[model samples]
Target chain A: MPTSSKIFISSVAQDAITHLRIGAFEELSRLGHDPQMFEKNFGPWPNFQTGVDHCLKKVSECDLYCLFIHTKGGSMTSNGYTVTHLEYLRAVSDSKMMMLYCESTIMDAYFKFRWIIAKYIEEFKLSQGRMPHNNEVVDFLEMESEKNPTSGIPSKHQIDTYVWVLLHDIVMVKGHYVEKLSWGHTVPWASYLSDLLQQGLQLLPKKSLYEESSQLALAFGDFTSFAKQVVSDHVRISELLEGRRLLNRSIRMLTRSEITAGPVNGSIGSVKACSAICLFHHEGNSLTVQYYAGDTNGNYDFEVGDPSSFVSYTYNNLQDGVPGLFYWESRRLFYLTYKLGEYVISYHFPEDTAWSSQLYADYTDDIINGILNTHANGMIIELLNSLIGGLQK
Target chain B: MSKKPTRLPAAQDGWHVQTTANALSPDKTVIAVNKQGTVLHMQRNGMSAIGKDTLLFVPTTRYTDNIIHHKHQRLNELNNTLTGLTVEG
Candidate 1:
């Protein structure tokens, strides 16, 4: 009983990982893999050294270490955060510890930097032959040459099909965390992603090569044909929800402020003096952002300010300084926000989109199922993934 | 009789959905509204823009004896009443 190929999940295992881990596991199981054979759990270690030891020991028990690289790995160089770096260091002794980078969508400026990192990672792969997608890495023009086939499938279609088949083989059939660049699941998901980018920007592919690639989903198994399939099977992912959220709260405290010894107190260079605080509550889908602000100047300034507070909510989109596009996308419900660099942006979506409830029920089912079949194997589930698919009935 | 939809001026190819509403509490504030009809509010940071939109609405909560319709709006009126105000980023 080769334990469901114990693959170690890495990276911060937060937002990005959550979206992919589970799908990866389900895909593998469909490929005839033992669903409970792989071990996804890792006992919490107290320190970085202990965690590394635990992680490394776990890797020793598996055939491959599936490392998920999200953005720039981590800031904590000492912690098990550098587990992938350590795996690379130990590559000579353990070449089986393959290092794969899960590529992310990045701006053009960062693309060149990503290339540099990919090159460095390739040098560490320790393989002699050039991998499938590396031609794009080696010379941008080489990609064009591969795209131009005299007949049959065009380059773009072949490339997409190449990635689609490769991903299905590695994830769905081979049941291995290992994958080639031809598969978008592995690092340098360039081919599959470039197609997605082309579609998103409303830009057509360089040729009909890509048009044919759309046939991949239609044809399944050996019997299916490109045209024989009357309907094209495509997957639609519902990411953002739209609707009103009756319950949601967000708070932000001022980081640095000047507290004056004078009467009114919060005096920022002779403005209307406010003392104490200001507060706002965005009730329903409609919300008001209120904060307590104190200002001090003359005695009357503080007097007028009081335990000062004010609230404001705008019913009009124009008043709120919000775009009118996603109103329906969010289903007009719960609030969603993302912090990028210096910008803090927020949006709202319907509450039903929250997967936690479904997640909780599934967890309960897993617990009951695991207890019944305590065959010492305990279930090994991947965290999350899209291509790997999830347990969908 | 047939019902007709009210056509707003400069009606683009998009529908107008309300995101935030504070009309109930005449004494409240709103943070932001996006194209998706999502209302978001935060404290301290007055400069918060979540999504892009053509029209922006900010209720004047702080009105003083000298300044009408709150300070920010009053300031805008002062500049806009004449040669339209140009807010520099």
Candidate 2:
């Protein structure tokens, strides 16, 4: 129950919330706390069911419920992530469980996530005949508000939202901040996290851009996350390569990935392979399965029930077990050799990162796939074409 | 008793007296001639005084020919203060 056992207050994003929590948490911890544990970046769950399962499991055991309530408004989720505001309802029912609210009023991209957490955003609005309680989350936020300067990416907006809610949570819930360590903090984890979060802010714009343009190498139907990453990718590839309109669907493309076995000097290399699953009303019963490397290199053409499928792989060759949502994080190669209708795509994958022939293939695959993966679809082509075509004319 | 010699009524003595009280431009050199005419100086924010108001005498002939056009200073140039330092010739 409320005994002096250690507990964690997790926030989906750390921004300045970590510091506020640290300061307020320190004061509460002085009352014989076991130390607070924080999990950043990993969730309120990235997917629907995952988030629900995670929140359910984590909230079940915690003595306190510190909710960072941001106002991104509401959002829909195909997965179970958005529908479960019931956790807050459950937490409120328990007398033993203390409740803390971190009110978020930032107006930006996080609005979606903020709304995703809305039903429990009591600090912002009155709840069941209750005057909004001031908690630690609100306290820290208000204190930090004194340092506001209205400029830049409006980070102050986010800082304001995060701090207010955190302070509100602590002050109102009378949350006894439990301190102490959890295994989530060791070497690579901490370094990896701090580095990623710090980097993610810088990387997000580009990352999100990359995920937006038609599903590049994405297997999962995560339109939202894909949109974000594509947007980011679009920004990145444009910067990475000088040439725009990088891909023309009509151009010849060769593909390969880091998921098959062999030496890849034109033969095979170590890289995984995937089977194609395609059914269309093109020609006669075109029921053909193609074999491809680990990476989705947009190559290969499987000629139906052909016994010896040759050098190319097609969408019709998806393997038996590969799920539609699974992504093979393998390095692949897509070499655009020819143009127009006679397009030939040779795909390859590297087996390992070692110094063997397979590794060489993966390395080479990285080089080509790096370019291929950066290739844009229609819009990019149109942009490049218009710019160039205008010049040409 | 010798009349205490009136301190030479030099001021009212025959002199070409010119004062803005009757002169053309009161705000400008209201030269008064005391039996002689010459220009004297009285410093003020402006040139002539009409009772209480001061009107600056912007002569048809400039006090000096060197001038800087008074279009508004550029954004960067017009800062809080204008430094008044000048190099000694």
Candidate 3:
């Protein structure tokens, strides 16, 4: 016994195929089938959100999905697919029986060119208030009218034929590839449609049309379960990675500068001197230090004199002139002072860390004693070396 | 649901009889079985025998390859019963 099934027709709006749609619907109904199309089935919703919802629900309820494609891809939506394209995907996901047809005929250049000429003339008349008297334009329009006798744009037959070919060559239904129906040449739409109905009806099983297939239910069930598990795992990984990133950033900020060097002897412009090096760990502090050693004459000007004049050795400012100059000085956190006789180097280390403060005071006292008495205690030098070399924390 | 047409095949409840022959013969007669464990003798016009004659086997005319025939018939019947007319195409 034969059965009637719900058929959903999907297509972009094409003026030429109105009659075809009507004819197909009539014939499908005559053959004991219920055909549903957007034009009739979709209600007048206030917004497209509701309208799309209704459309998709109807598509899911349908037993057969028919697609019509032409050259136009149609307007894109937020999901980057055209409305008809989304419907096609939904049908596939639902595992509904699907048929695709694409128009394949390329419009002849001569005909197309003439149509273009005719369009230009019509537009010119509207804009210029007179018919274009150009001989070429007149001749082209006349020729196009005589040869085609239809709208210059894609004809309904051409569009339908293209859709037929597209479906035949490309679309896949269920797990099997779709076979293209040869609707080209002189094959009339009615005859092709008759064959389509017969073939379609034969393929369907003799069961309730609305009943869900067991195969689809099982496939979707497992897929949904697996997808949920994957999403859960992804969320867990993201949380763990975020915590690790925060911890690493804090550690990096704390150890921004962790190096110190040199209590070396040298001479600057025949004046005797000594120098030491340390890196400031705070932001806005220059990460380099330069000292001129043995400047007893005090006759060598530091900035104005040519750099070669001072027997000065620069360090930490490896690539540039002057380091430790730009850091926190405006806040009065940085200071420098020097004297010509028995030159003493002292620094006021911030009292924030007891170990670093004590180390700084001890180093400064040793430098003073070395300059004033000219006798450096070997044990004091060793203790200063150990503190500077070891990790303060 | 629309009512079945008078000329269409009669509804066969829970039974889809087929010829048991290796190659189905073209003759108007064939024997088949249904899932209900009943042997059936089928003819081109109607069932010749059904379940040892316990059930009435009236001949029906609706037997075509049009798969959607029953569906369309049901839809027509629903429309008619609810609205007193078939929906226009």
Report the CAPRI category for model 1.
incorrect
DockQ values of all predictions: 0.01, 0.00, 0.00
Q: Model 3 shows how many backbone clashes? A: 40
Name the TM-score of candidate 1: 0.22
Q: Specify the highest-DockQ model's number.
A: 1
| lDDT score at residue B53, model 3, on the 0-100 scale | 17
Model 1: share of real contacts kept: 0.00
Cand 1, B chain, TM? 0.25
The true-versus-predicted C-alpha distance at residue A131 of model 2, in Å, is 24
Query: For model 3, how does the per-residue alpha-carbon lDDT over A198-262 read when each residue is reduced to its tens digit?
Result: 76567455323323343343444455445443443333321223422332332222211111111
Q: Arrange candidates, best lDDT first.
A: 3, 2, 1
Overall local distance difference test of candidate 1: 0.29
Candidate scoring better on lDDT of 1 and 2: 2
Instruction: In model 3, state the lDDT of residue B25.
Output: 21
Across A140-172, the per-residue lDDT of candidate 1 in tens digits comes to 322433654432322432222222222222222
TM-score of chain B of each: 0.25, 0.16, 0.22
Off by over 4 Å in 2: A1-11, A24-30, A34-51, A71-87, A93-96, A102-393, B1-89
Top candidate on lDDT is 3
